[model samples]
Target: MTRSSHSLRTRDLGYAQRVCVAKAGKLMMQTGQLTPRARVGLAVSGGVDSLAMLAVMAIRRRIVPFPVELLLLHLNPGFDPHNHRPLVELCAGLGIPAHIETTDFGPRAFSEENKKNSACFYCAWLRRKRLFDLCATYGLTHLAFGHNADDLAATFMLNLFQNGRVDGLSSRESFFSGRLTVIRPLLLIDKPTIVRAAKAWELPVFSNPCPMAGKSMRHEAETWVRSICAGDKHRNVSLQHALGRWQLDRDALPD
Candidate 1:
């Protein structure tokens, strides 16, 4: 279908919102995370960030220079009393194809067999492995995640304080010998902007179902980072960049 036809099916998110979306798309393009005819799988978790990312990506495809295919992929962590209807409905409304599957990652991570590793680590690893498998099976060129600037800042702090290393999130990183690349178009965008957009755009966001929600070490780090960046967005951004450089330098060192 033509761009105009596609636009007709999706709601007009207004100029301001469109600008936000365009800004994210531009950032991805500048970083080479997005390219013409790229096939991307969006790893949506039904949270505010992921939901907004999925919508923005779909909208981006309709307006970009060349045709790009997008597929929404959601892996349910087998949390009881959870519903994916909102996500499904949103994808249907946007005319985007989605693949939803349930998994025992959460349970397995919390089970007795998970004594060696923390539940968070095991669950994330399992989910990531499944995502990579899905990308390979579906012929996806890249996998897009919804991590924003705030997430980057928190991640840097987590690595430094918890792991005693300098590391930060990357905007784009290749995986499995470059068979599939992971991209974060929203990396430059802040969480507040994403939260506002999710509300303003009425994204079908849902709360995270993981039992460790708001209680993980990452959560504690994020809270601390949030307090540190209380009224200084620039500080948060600067910290990420500065620490990210240190990480690069660290990686360059010889063992």
Candidate 2:
């Protein structure tokens, strides 16, 4: 039985539909990512990637496998809480509940770190901790981040050169401390997919400068990736494909 997006409530989708919230709902099912009844706690930073993923997941709720009930969790580590309003509006328009919270990750902590290295490493580490804590508080089992394939590839290369690791971000990981599972549904998608989808769907962009945007190494990497993509078109897509194929050929490469 086929169902349109109009027929879905917050609880109709099954497990298979939860992780592959943006792609064909059956992808995860066919791959056995989840059973028939999984719930996902999505993290939305009010960015194009996160917003795009949110909209896609909303549409996916009317799908099969598992109904993904999105609980928008926003953590203001150093970014403005007001900067997240667009996400609130987007959720409201989508008729989903969005929650906001602020953590006192003092500005000093970020400023001090920004001097030696990009602010992202420290800030992101903290935000992730906050996000995980929120998931535990809400009793949400699976937590999703909006990291697309582009991010994975860039980070992988960056880590290879800088961190001496062959890993970037894992598709599915269990938080070492909390053992909470984290996933990336959009890991196969890229910035173009996100940008086009956000514009096409009119996803609200939260106007906030992540305190370490231009100064962060990941942001720098993103800029570099975009610059190269602008000059040579295939760099972006090729990297994305490489990531997927690499994972397929060797799901667990010895690190």
Candidate 3:
């Protein structure tokens, strides 16, 4: 890429980032969960999704007409001990406080003791438990995740096929009798949009260190869901609406 071309690409990416942030912020405001003065714990996993979520939330905090404090939280999962510095630095650059917890959740999940459940299941359960504990520890009013619309659809299919139910991921779920709310601001944003925005913003997205990174049930479900959507943005959004998880306006995209 030539210097001018590279600069143009960067500018386009910056515009993509702005659009993503605007859509995310709009969805968050629609949910009415991210209130003023809310202390939110953002779960950053070093993946493009979570990293992009961090950037979107950080930017939204600044431009939105509210005073919300964001804290970046990462659980190392014992797979890589030295991979958290980039996330910490990113949080620093965004002027958000970060808390990194180094745990052996990954290894333990694959241990023999965890025989019944899949490693992904065990690892995710433990990670969520720790995140919830951190939220309580920090007295955070909300915990934000990077799960997007595609995740919601795949999860719905996963549950329907595996458990035989209509249960799907909720955009806003309350926990601890409403003391701490779990919010998915990207719930209405599709995965491709997130990928594009992440690329434009040049987030420090690292490869998944989990041994079963692309070999899990969830991965299979995601692949199947992608094929079902077949790169159609409208199909992706319609699937999310059909799952009854989101009530977005017809003009979902920001002008």
Candidate 4:
């Protein structure tokens, strides 16, 4: 099927397919996105980030020499059915099979007693556990998450504020639960970049009305980062470069 052109150029990279993927593919090839005969499971929330990720990966698949099998996984952790329908339609449009795992952790779990806190930690932990279990059942070797540079930035500040140290998502991570490896291809792309790419491609999006949406202080951190980086413009690029160059002393800070 021929693809339409316009703002969606980012999603439909036909014009720049060869050049962009070649560039992105080289980085991916070095990072195991080019693993030979690997079955990869992407934890897709059907948001713009993951959708753009799938779009780019689809382009890379056509040119990357390595054989990669891709699958999409979505967890329905008690969100409105109406709110999640678009994601289902999206995977269908992309022609990728999506796995939906329903996990409504009983009522009182995040109830009146826990009103003080949103209980997002409990909810996310539950989701990850289910994702891991699904990976084991399906024999998936690698997992892809939609975490981007902005998320890493937000997390670094949050960690330092909460724990008095700097730490955040790495390009690669290992899940000890089942020896499964996880990769964040978007780690190099900032949220603004992703937004630009998504808009450039005219990709349709879904909303996340989760109970934990705006309450977190992370919003404040993101705003602060936006303000600080607004002037330098290269602020984010510099941050990624610095983090990329980091070598762990392990004992660099107090234990």
Candidate 5:
């Protein structure tokens, strides 16, 4: 569709309450994440962040100039048996195709046999591998994740404090020799904003059933970031600015 046609259609959708969707669309265009006629696979975990991502992408697909196809991929780690149903129904309401997979990654990750690895680590690894497999099987060019700005900040602190690295999550990353690109369009938005967006969009948010939900290193980092940004009104902005500067310097360095 032409730009004018796309604008008209977006106006017709009457999505004024979906400011997050517009912001996500703009971010995708700014970062060159979504190409024309791209098949995008969204990893929806039924959580607020992922559900918000799905809602925004669904709106974007309606009015984007390119012929974009969105497919939902929900991985059920058997943490909760009924968790996948809401995700499936949400996709159906949006008229998008969804693929749901069930695995024992949850139980096995926490089992004694895998005591060497953290449950979070094992579950994340398995889910990512499964996502890549799905991408290859379904011919998807790009995979979209719901890593927001808070996630980015927390990860940066986590690496700095725990791993002796200043690295954080990138908005876009490539894997398998650039065969599949992973994009995080929500990298520019914060968690509170995403929560508000989820509410405004009426996303079906599901609670994570992981026993280690609020006790990981990431959680500690999140608490630290929040406390640092608590009293100072501009602390969050300063951190974001610092991250941007660091990214520029990092990009300019040798590979």
Candidate 6:
């Protein structure tokens, strides 16, 4: 990339970053996910989505009223040995503390012994468990994921179609008896916006090394959703609004 082009890209990314931080900060305040002086861990997967989340969080921390100590936590599933260095370097450049863990979850999940469990399912389960363990070990209050509006919509569709329920992902969820919380600050942002930001910022986005990257049920749901929304640009917006209202209604019901 040339210097002039790089400068323009940085300028564009600065604008995108500002928008992301503003939206994310508002979500954080409304959800009350992060408290002042709280330590939060970002689950960085070296992908565009997670990298964008990392950038947004870093920017939001400086501008928000409360103080949040950000930490980068990565779990290398041993799919690609060279996949994690960019994540570490990004954390270093951001001046945040980072912890990277390696495991053979990828290989093991794809092994013959685990034929019953899909590779995608097994990998996700192991990665999430490892993240929870990391939070417990490091005393982090919250773990932030890179799940966006598309993911939420896709999940909603998956549940509605497969499980016969109107369930979807939540922006904030408590686990382990409220000892730890999982938050998704990008719930209101769409994948296209994230992709633009990632490209503008020149993030070192890495591809998923999993053999079944595009063969998962989630991917199928995404494709279906896109096909449904092909002509109507407002379809996703409608889905997000409906999902939010449904969640609110569910929350209001008696327990």
Which is superior by TM-score, 2 or 4? 4
28: Cα error in model 2, Å: 3.5
Clashes of each: 0, 8, 0, 4, 0, 0
Q: After superposition, how far is residue 116 of candidate 6 from its true place, in Å?
A: 2.9
lDDT of 5 by residue, 84-167 (tens): 777665666677899998888889898986877888898889999999999999999999999887888899999998999779
Q: For all the candidates, what are their Cα RMSDs to the real structure?
A: 4.4, 5.7, 5.1, 5.0, 4.7, 3.5
CA lDDT for candidate 2: 0.63
Worst 10 residues of 4 by lDDT: 246-255
Alpha-carbon error at 75 in model 2, in Å? 0.9
Writing each residue's lDDT as its tens digit, candidate 2 over 77-149 gives 6546456655555666667776687765536456654576445556667777788777878777678778887
Candidate 2 TM-score versus the reference = 0.78
Query: Which of the two, 4 or 5, has more TM-score?
Result: 5
Worst 10 residues of 2 by lDDT: 1-10
Off by over 4 Å in 2: 1-27, 30-34, 106-108, 111-118, 176-179, 223-230, 249-255
Q: How would you encode candidate 6's per-residue C-alpha lDDT over 81-193 as one tens digit per residue?
A: 77788776666667789999788999989888687888888888999999999998999999999988788889999999988987888778889998898898887677888
Model 3 stretches astray by more than 4 angstroms: 1-13, 231-234, 244-255
- lDDT values, one for every candidate: 0.79, 0.63, 0.79, 0.64, 0.79, 0.80
- What's the candidate order when arranged by decreasing lDDT? 6, 3, 1, 5, 4, 2
Which regions of candidate 6 are displaced past 4 Å?
Answer: 1-15, 248-255
Q: Candidate 3, residues 172-233: lDDT per residue as tens digits?
A: 77899999998888877777888988886767788888999999998998988889879697
Off by over 4 Å in 5: 1-18, 244-255
